[model samples]
Target: MSSAPSSTVFLASPDADTPAAAQALATIRERVLAATARGTPLDIQGGNTKRWYGQTPAGEPLDMRMYRGIVSYDPAELVITARAGTPLAEIEATLAERGQILPFEPPHFGPGATLGGCIAAGLAGPRRPHVGAPRDFVLGAVIMNGQGQVLHFGGQVMKNVAGYDVSRVLAGALGTLGVLLELSIKVLPCPVAEATLRFALPQAQAIEQLNRWGGQPLPLMGSAWHDGVLHVRLGGAAAAVAAARATLGGEPVDAMEAHAFWQSLREQSHPFFANAPLMGDGQPLWRLSVPPTTPPLAHSDEHLIEWGGAQRWWITPRAAADVRAIAAAAGGHATLFRHGDKLAGVFTPPPAALRAIGERLQHAFDPSRIFNRQRLYR
Candidate 1:
């Protein structure tokens, strides 16, 4: 375990507090207010790396890359606050310098990926199941609502809350709720030691084995199955990793290869994703998230099972309804992760009650519906 320093560290340079940064923020707020007054929609953009994700962006672009930098860091407290436009790589590198990390392992789809976009997309990597999701790490946020008023939620530290944690709400809201300004996020110590093991097993056997091991006190940090091979990553104290490795027998994977494999899985740069057709091409990539215990769905080639079998990716030309039905039947949902016919919808529709709640939240946060309108729902 890692501990924070007694006092918080102000990571911002003079540049962060300079008039330029302030002016950038003011410019964004003014734009929002002007858009609201004129009844115009604003497409909130950060890096535009994931611009193709979710519904098509509407309204005039509100570029956010200008307002960026780390605001503060508390290593002992394991919290970091930064402007929404701060590059994700910068934050990760900063955390890495101190042997800390965002445990959820967010994916940077492109070099230009930003903190705001990471939260908006809310996509986690292979380590998610062993740790948690993006929402789980969010401590607080500063956002500009439809009225252009900045609203703050949560704080620098974690505590029990009676109602909705608005900070977490913004995690996957796709900026539909408001304009993400700055965010405080919880981080964790990087594993002290790590290793990957390989197993040859069928999908059913792999799922069963992973679930079985999941119930045990193993240092399982990441797991993935593709092309009849299952790779499990063990991380923790050296003794713990060694003990787990000895207990769970599998061929050892080279350290560098293991790192590259997990990175590929995290970035979706693996051959499975590479082989998938582009949006207008023949086939599209689909991500099916079901219970870890759920049996494998009937699917064709070029598929990868990850998160201990809870998150599966497949490349297919299947109908949207058919793919969604399969996931729903398994008590989960399917997302057209990339390169798909989005007119049929990229995400499964929320149930009526959930949809109603979302609608209410949207209305409450952006009555003018001026912020990234229909980015999530549509």
Candidate 2:
């Protein structure tokens, strides 16, 4: 598993700001205005770990790390707001103190991961099938459009639904829509009890069992099947976990090992991913999202399935078109996740109607097309 250094910096309160942070915000606004005036694009950046993702960035770098700090956090209300540049480690540490979490289990990828980058990437971990995705938890956001105007959408409380859809749209826009400034995200308390079980079943059998169990009430937190074993995690109330554990007969896994194993999967440090760099030349990591009930695709030695079969990861030297064709035939799309010849394409192109809607939104939010231009598409 990949072990990266953890960020030790404790973020300051949202209400308090150092002089340097104020200057950073003002400087960013100025840069946005100038870029809009010149019709030049600005490549919004954070941490730089995920730079390899998406299309090749095309614009002057706009570092967001300078504008950092928590804006507000109310543990009782289960809500936290922080600047886009605030380090994700800091936020997680703060939330852990209150026995709460982001629920979506966003992967850090690297120690320098920032809130803005997390929202821009909009990736969810193993728990996604149980709880929700990143966009679902986003309560609101403050964004700076191409006109250098700051726009606010949604609100802190869950009941505040006005403009909520607009706020959620910024979750995975990759900064193509606008520069994400601050975000208010809903949080959830940590589960009271948790347990991990192991079932030595083949891929097809595992998928069938997962889908069957998915229909009944159970505290299914996360699941993964690779090689010959399927691992399942149960969480929530102690009684519920125990009841489910008794019902689902399987070998038990040590608590510590289970935590580490799940963490490895969330951070993409599992053995499956750790071997990606060594998967031979031209081999790229492909993420396939299909119906949970969809049968397995063509077998590969490096295949790993997660999210109850909804998300599958495979590394192969197959041509991009061939890989996409297989995924499409299975009723889903494919993403060129990592280490590939992206000249062909990183994401499967959206349908015409979806593409048109995206264009209209881009025009409405960034008419100048000066924010991370071509980052999401050509």
Candidate 3:
């Protein structure tokens, strides 16, 4: 193991490395283990889109940006493996060529989002509830734990999560558990064709429509957050989509329109981003994931509850106490997705057991607390 500096200013720079699979793995493992020994934390960053998330920390960021690229793509198996630092756009393009997709509905801000960041955040677009979360398709990973020891979890062969399920456990873990060097994810083949249906319905009616479609085999690629319109995307065989379209009365929007709509929803652009100019000094953006059947818009007055009914994006200038209360009432987890403050907590209340488990895992991987110390769990 190599010993590097205790800490370095961790923004716009990262612990660098090459894109080669072996080289990337070696560098990440070395940096994380060293971080643990030095008792220095790391600031894990991607395209830096969600940099404002939670409380920002001061430490050496084990920047994964340097280790990037697709490692392997097996079209027959529908599994794609890539370095953690590989850009999401690159992943999508690779999958598109093979006629396969992530199916978890990953959103890319630009040419910057890395595969590692997506897994750590567990971000899924409107199609999440229907298919699954980022973890559902997660097959395996090669990670550098906090202890500076490299560990591989899950398996390349399908249906092979034999013993401990560390791969699934790390989803949405915010790099608190370990540093993902490379990941092997089960993918889905792309459909032959796809289309979306836009219906103008009130909030209640939209909810009902979504539930109805959920019961049926409508290939819902994405839905929701259209100013006042309820947009439901259907993807699959052209025959299937056409049949579904015949039953409904909707003017088919072109592929361009549909793609643009989904991309916006993927990144939470509409409604919230619309007020960018009006936002002064930057208030925080809170994301709440609620059940579809919540009290009919109890907090509707304060925030914009979109995505059928599950995901919500609340932009408030109020205090954190008020936001947490609303999320608790709505039945979901509250996360400071984007904020101006560098010291405010990103997540609401993490369960005691979960926190304890996280701490133990952190220690196991990084005994020295080398990576992002107290940034997530503190």
Best-performing candidate as measured by lDDT = 2
Instruction: Please tell me which predicted candidate would have the highest TM-score against the true structure.
Output: 1
Please write out the lDDT profile of model 1 over residues 21-47, one tens digit for every residue.
889878998999999999989999998
Q: How far does residue 313 in candidate 1 sit from its true spot (Å)?
A: 0.5
Pairs with backbone N, CA or C atoms under 3 Å apart (clashes), candidate 2 = 14-70, 14-71
Sorted by TM-score (best first), the order is 1, 2, 3
Clashes of each: 4, 2, 12
Q: What's each prediction's TM-score?
A: 0.95, 0.94, 0.86
Residue 269: error of model 2 in Å? 0.9
- Runs in model 2 with CA error above 4 Å? 1-18, 277-282
Better of 2 and 3 by TM-score: 2
